[model samples]
Target: MVSEAQLRTIIAEAVPTIDAAKLPADVAFADSGIDSLDYAAILLALQERHGLVVPDEDLSRTASIAGILAYAAEHRSDA
Candidate 1:
């Protein structure tokens, strides 16, 4: 169970220049100014941090913070 704080920290590290406070937890990544490269970077970061490999298909479908959170939760054991 990744806490909200952890998620925020991840986003902060991924996009240091962005004002994460203005971003909603359930908002889509596209609407949050996260481009494809940023998304790929995030997926890599998650893999390095949690030792879990997120599939490309899953990454494609994860458009929102909430969606990512749910995916992480479901794959917690793998992490």
Candidate 2:
């Protein structure tokens, strides 16, 4: 399973300029300053890093870091 730390790291790498300390675990990608393009980038990065396919619907619904983590946990086996 992908841990919260790993998820945070992934998010950090995807948007290096963001202050991770201000990013809440439950903060949505949009709320954290990650727009549609950034979200797509994050999804692609996750797929490339873990060899898992994140559904577009799921990606669209990922509004917060917690949501993303939950999605990752759900798709961990596939990864």
Candidate 3:
């Protein structure tokens, strides 16, 4: 399953400007200064690497680290 560490790594790789290690778990990307473009890159990386696609309707469920983690735990697959 996709874990927080994996998510952080993805974020770090997707947006080099953002320090994923210091990112707050429950804070939304907007609150953390991660713009929509970078956030979309992170989401794309997650999809490309982990096969965890965040549907358009599920954007709210991935707005924060905690929320993304929860969504990954529930929807991430190893296939």
Q: Candidates' TM-scores?
A: 0.83, 0.79, 0.90
Q: How many steric clashes between backbone atoms does each model show?
A: 0, 3, 0
Tell me how far the alpha carbon of residue 55 in candidate 1 is from the true structure, in angstroms, after superposition: 0.4
Clashing residue pairs for model 1 = none
Error of 1 at 42 (Å): 1.0
Candidate 3 weakest lDDT stretch, 10 residues: 70-79
Which 10-residue window of candidate 2 scores lowest in summed lDDT? 54-63
What's the lDDT of the predicted structure labeled candidate 2? 0.73
| lDDT (tens digit, per residue) of candidate 2 on 1-79 | 5666766777788888897656887767777788787777777876887765777666655567777677777777876
Sort order, TM-score high to low: 3, 1, 2
lDDT of 3: 0.87
Q: Which ranges in model 3 have alpha carbons more than 4 Å from their true place?
A: none
Arrange candidates, best lDDT first.
Answer: 3, 1, 2
Q: Model 2 residue 36 lDDT?
A: 81
Runs of candidate 1 exceeding 4 Å displacement = none
